[model samples]
Target: MAENGFQGALTYIYDPAILLRLTSFQAEYKNGVTPLNPGETLKLRPLCLEDYDKGYLQLLSQLTSVGDVTREQFEDRFNKMKACDDTYYVTVIEDTTSKQVIGSATLVKEQKFIHRSTARARVEDVVVNDSYRGKQLGKVLVDVLVSLGRELGCYKVSLECKDHNVKFYTIFGFEAGKGQNYMQIRFFD
Candidate 1:
């Protein structure tokens, strides 16, 4: 349990299996996973109150191509997240040295409404600035968030991207559910 610690914090014990897995990951780096092209002065750190608007908005603007999220909408969502009860909230990436909001990732879990109780985490708002896209920052951000979701007992970590993003998610082992229904209500006035 202590094997996977919070970002920037050291875990207590040396779990051999975890260590071996990490070693194997690094050794097989270029085989399948998105290769981490060197980023400009970036660091993966926990989001802060200061990021609620600055870094958060910067990342949200990059979603212009995705055509669903907007800066104002992101702020509203961020406000809602701040006030939700049972929400696992955190922005798990940052670019400190460059002072740029290069990329970000978040996880939200909802309780099941059935007789059986379970929590399902949905990863959302994975964005990387235009300058950072080809560098594979999105994959790294999602990878970290998925790890957090599993650690917190999430039944599954699911996310949705545009149809054009199929190949990107495919490389990370995500598949369309065989018979799942997807519906959405855009806030149109």
Candidate 2:
């Protein structure tokens, strides 16, 4: 596969231009969205194979146990996701100055037959590095995924978070279902 090309897809899933146009930050800044700091360089884009060295897995470890995944394993998973067409959108925010992934999020689109065969999206693995917590990067990540879900024609998007983070998600229009529960069956402990 080419560096910037997908096997048979029309567009690259990790294209930065997608974020530039779909994020709320762009809506706020009609002209263009600038970095968080005038002197610092920050970029919001989709995950790429080279990200393996950019602390991509290290950043994910901050959210959950990433286990010792090798570079080959990372690329294998990435290739599988890309093969699924547009089902997965793993977005990332990089501190270009430091060449490290600072924050990340994923939108997984699920095809459904109930809602007139329309698809729905699940927002998952949203996290920001400890050192970069104060900035609005989290908000930006959520906004980007939500907007991408809509653009993909998903009927609705949902996510699960701890009780403490409920208030934060609410700001992005996520509401807790009255009697809904998030049950999980872990295969490994």
Candidate 3:
């Protein structure tokens, strides 16, 4: 597989068979878009440059106070993000019928030296389009990300959500505030 393992180094040889399987898997994925509603062909995929201008960021802003970014700003950031193998995987839910990005969630793999060089994954920035709420798209999005985190060999997967959304996320196996407090230090306003 030749992926970046603990200590941030490739510890195995690149397997062509694995690559072929991944290619075939992606081909099947691209062709099979999940239908969520009538006239809406939704599919889940990794973020691509082609999705930059398709209201992807707008959907994200609905989650938090992320200001708008110019196309150049997004391009620069996307380049750096994609360069790091599977460290940052932002999965988007796209309506292929309308070519609109309606939902997104990110799975971040954190390799650690503790716990016998184990790794964990965090899910964040989960949101769905305002018009698409109550369709269970958010649940579908988080489930996909959790599956991905498991495939990445993460020992645990976690996420922090607003108090109101705690119950919503709990159904996905996340313990709501289980003897742990979430604190943050912001470097920017």
The root-mean-square deviation over C-alpha atoms between each candidate and the true structure, in angstroms, is 7.2, 4.7, 8.5
Q: Estimated TM-score per prediction?
A: 0.66, 0.84, 0.77
lDDT of 2 at 131: 95
The sequence of per-residue lDDT tens digits that candidate 3 reaches over residues 1-189 is 124211123111111122112211111112223222212467655676767768888888888877868889987888777777658878777787777889888888898898789899999888899998766777767766676667667899988878898877776677765588989999985
Alpha-carbon runs more than 4 Å astray in model 1: 1-40, 52-54, 64-86, 113-115
- Candidate 1: deviation at residue 72, Å? 13
Candidate 2 C-alpha lDDT tens digits along 34-122: 43221147767788778898999999999989999999998888988989987889988888789898998999999999899999999
Q: Which stretches of candidate 2 lie over 4 Å from their true place?
A: 1-15, 23-40
lDDT of 1 at 42: 60
In terms of lDDT, which candidate is stronger, 2 or 3? 2
Candidate 2 weakest ten by summed lDDT: 30-39
Estimate every model's Cα lDDT from 0 to 1. Answer: 0.57, 0.78, 0.67
Q: Rank the candidates by TM-score, best first.
A: 2, 3, 1
Tens-digit lDDT track of model 1 for 19-106: 1232111111332443222244565554544454445665676664434556567556656665675564454445657566677666
Candidate maximizing TM-score: 2
